[model samples]
Target chain A: MSEAIAPALLAPGRTAGMNWRRLVPLLLVAPLVLFMLALYALPVLAMLSRSLLEPAPTLAHYAELAGDEVFHRIFTNTLWTTLVVTAGTLVLGYPVAMGLARARTLLPLLLIIVLLPFWTSVLVRSYAWMVLLGRHGLVNEALLAMGMLDRPLRILNTPLAVHIAMVHILLPYMILPIANALRQIDPSLARAAAGLGAGPWAVFRQVTLPLSMPGVMAGILLVFVLSLGFYITPALVGGPRDMTLSMLIAQRVEQLDWAYAATLSAVLLATALVIIAIFQRAFGVGTAFRMSAR
Target chain B: MTLAGRGASVALNSLEKRYEGFGAVRGVSIDIRSGEFLTLLGPSGSGKTTTLMMIAGFETPSAGDIAIDGRSVVALPAHRRNIGMVFQNYALFPHLTVAENIGFPLKQRGVAKAERARLVEEALELVRLPGYGTRQPRQLSGGQQQRVALARAIVFKPRLLLMDEPLGALDKQLRESLQLEMRRLHADLGITFIYVTHDQEEALTMSDRIAVMHEGRVAQIGPPEELYDRPENRFVAAFIGESNFLPATVRGREEGHVVAECAGSLVRATCTTNPAPGESVTLAARPERLRFVDGGWPAPPPANRLAVTVTEAVFVGERCRYVLRTGDGTSLVLKEPSSAATRRRVAGETAEVAWSVADTILV
Candidate 1:
């Protein structure tokens, strides 16, 4: 066993003979590797292969998708909604994350509150948004009773409703990473800034904000990539004019156009990966993380 | 040398800080001289750091006032006070390059960009970190980071500078080197530096005066030698250095010295804190002050003598420490420089220890 399993200590630059020690690591991960290859990668490859080889070995589906006016609108709509939802969650979550980092005694309860939304089903949460955003929903009815509204507001099935629901769903993803980052900051940095003649606002703008960039980048990456493929919230809450790439893919699949649906899915996956690459280029996570090292 | 500061004198009057019925500092007052380095030295929770924080305008005193150069700054916020402070953790901004971090204070004061750059370079050179301007703080070693923090604090040319155990995080060898650098920094800048540390040696080595704090109050404040040689109270005596305490009853006053009966011997010692006759007190004598009586001694064997048995003898490189037991079962230590001329005493040997009146303090 020792002769077969031992490293090539006696002979440098030589490969070891068949070793159970080396196989142990591979054996440990074999289940997960096999599961992903069979269930995930195989299906994804089969779907993508349909875009190129289904019914005929031709690129007609991709050529049509590029020139399709409706496809362009849906693609841009998806990009626009993803950007707004990311911005919305960021603007709202940064403060909550800062508060959560500072509220040490209340941290456990606050964390539970931040993570509570994940326990609810996405379909149920989308329905809850619908009930609250309908024509005679709680918001408009309250505004009308307060004498601030002259007529019923058209809020349901709008981009605003889609934005509200998406931001609510994706907020936890934004908050957790940012709070973890904020908690890692050496609090004395702010005090040091203040002592060095910086006012409160300058301290925040120069020290606190810059030091928390890694967390902010992580949050944006998570929320942006997640919202790019978001389907249920928008489908249940958005008007017909707010069709996204995922919605188009759903429509094509329902009409028995599997090749075009696969083409759209390929485009969505490639776009998401390209966007992530661009973000990485603009703000490398490694550099940001190293900058914050103690 | 050109960056020397016009040091501001700080006066903390009746400064008190209490949080939630717990008094962190109670009625502490100290008048700090300009260009003088004063150290607040004590154990943790002794209110040394609190006293420092109140001076830097970080903690609002529950009572009394703080004046910088005779101007009341009680209403002034920390940033408006123009006091530079170095925290215990260096506290360098992680995202900023060394130069940018140093230039931060100048930028905040609305200094022009060109001038700020020049001053940042000058400050870096002042801390011997020239050309490290573009390097981020994480790239520097712990000592280098602390020096950068020091440079940043002093670059703004604040009249006063405060430090809170800045060398506590470093190793002993690094701390010693930094201590020398700080003393030189103080001399070059000529700024009033208020430092807080629990290290007695650091306080004695660096400060023009040391304030020994205990339980929310300044137990004693004086020059290092004064605090070491003539401690006014038992706390100051015990806190500064090793002392052999002999419980005694005051016999009478003899020639401006307090005569006391201690450990089966009559002892004469200095007594600024006057003790009336028959009052119980403690006589504090440094170990080096006590000597072994031998034929080599002068005609009269000093003033006080005690019969003791050598309980233990420890050779600590330079000196031989003898732990002696008195007839009354009191243990006292006597340290003598190891010399080949004198015979060494072993445990269980009978010996007579002698010391002079001028060397002992009646506390």
Candidate 2:
């Protein structure tokens, strides 16, 4: 009797002739697929097509962008600031992530501090940094009071202000992945390295850092890509000379130069894709996004 | 790999480790000779692993000093102490290949690449993993990974090797095989090995000396046979192996042996601890040292004997084990060869158990 029931159980289609189990998941995801296609993919593709078909199907806009010296300066500025912000986040976030991974009693407190910025709006965070780095602000006032500075430093409305505010906004993005990676590493590896006569620095270089590379890579890619597209933080904190590509694209749209804006957006999208493709080829995406070192 | 005269002697002078006013290891002083294979054998939280960590310099002692070759190394960090440690999890670097993992210490010490390769290859061969240099740690089985961990620890030829339950992760069969392999490696390298394990059989099978720890103290430390045959206290006797502890009253002392009255019978056991007459004592006897007397065979005239009722008789391959209850309801276990003479005694039958004076000790 059990043997007779076994084949019927195995052949579910024999009874219903339909596999709703498989179809249910596809049906469940169909709405998301349609939503993304309608809301995200179509508009982006339509905007990209304008770069080719706009101004009577001429590539003149892209040529103009390439030859324009102001565009070149803003593009270089964007790249430099993005690189600086990415590097700054890495250097500032690594030790905090390491501390979070190893902390026993202070873990929750440190985690809360790392995550506090995420609770606030990005605009608010940028404005807060503007206040802190502004002339006659708290830092300048303190420095002046301490007699350490002869005059108020021009910290706000410069490339330095943009870099600092962007780093502050994107630091949690850098820290969380690295902390997750560091947490996944077995602590025995460090002890084992030490036991084999590697000092603290050697242990970190040999074991801890190498194992945490995936998270580090993830943080770098996320921070760099996000910083490349930063608009309000740079616009609010940056001086006129520190104009970024995103700010320029926004300005072109406001001026009703839709063709130029589309061309610039296409360039930004292409650059992001090329950067991702280079990194993906250099280190497999699987390694970069791996959840655990093991 | 040959070592230089088995490394240095380690002396832990009254080592104490207290965590927030609670003692983890209290007053542990052990003098390990050069090249000695000393195993700190104890149950979990018994301070054996803590003691090993202190010697490895991973944990600082709250008080007391540790010395290598009579020179204090308490202030030295782990890397400067020249000690090799094999963690229970193996702790192999997942990112490095087996060869790179084995050669990591050599690289850290600034050895040339060519020489590092030679030494790594030799270490791999020593651990019986030659030609497996390119394999990742995840590609290997548990036993293979264990061997890689051992190779990595010993490749640097450190003065001492500390293994914290290296075989704890393997199955019983694999653990047994690895125990023999580790013993062989210790012999070949002639380096001091301080091994930690909670398994009694593993300790007995591997170590030249076993320190049985209990409640943050060493209950007994001696050669395996000596520890097994003559444990110092009740904890040691019970922890090292199975034992029957019976409450007894000391009747008298004669020739350094105590005559104790227990379970309506008189037992004469050797007593290192002198108990006055009429004082309460405990007599410990191993099951193998006791046998049942039946009708077919005559009972041996031993110094200690008890009249017990056989409550259960179990056939355990080569032998039969009988759980017996004495007249005063004191339970005892007796083991005898599974011969025709012993097979007749079943549950609910009366039997006379006997043991020699030397086999039973007063604790």
Candidate 1 residue A100 C-alpha distance from true site, Å? 0.9
TM-score of 1: 0.95
Model 1 lDDT tens row, A1-294: 475335555443444434545677899999999999999999999999999998889999889988999999889999999999999999999999999989978999998999999789989999999988898988889999999999989887999999999999999989988887888888888888888888999987998888788889888988998999999999999999988889888999999999999999999999988977887899986753443454
Runs in model 1 lying further than 4 Å from the true structure: A1-30, A287-294, B3-5, B295-300
DockQ of each: 0.77, 0.81
lDDT of 2 by residue, A184-214 (tens): 9998888888878899999998899998988
Which ranges of candidate 2 are over 4 A from the true structure?
Answer: A1-28, B295-301, B339-341
TM-scores for all predictions: 0.95, 0.95
lDDT of every predicted structure (CA atoms): 0.89, 0.90
Candidate 2 residues B213-283, lDDT tens each?
A: 88788889999998889988989899888999899999998887899999989889987877899999889
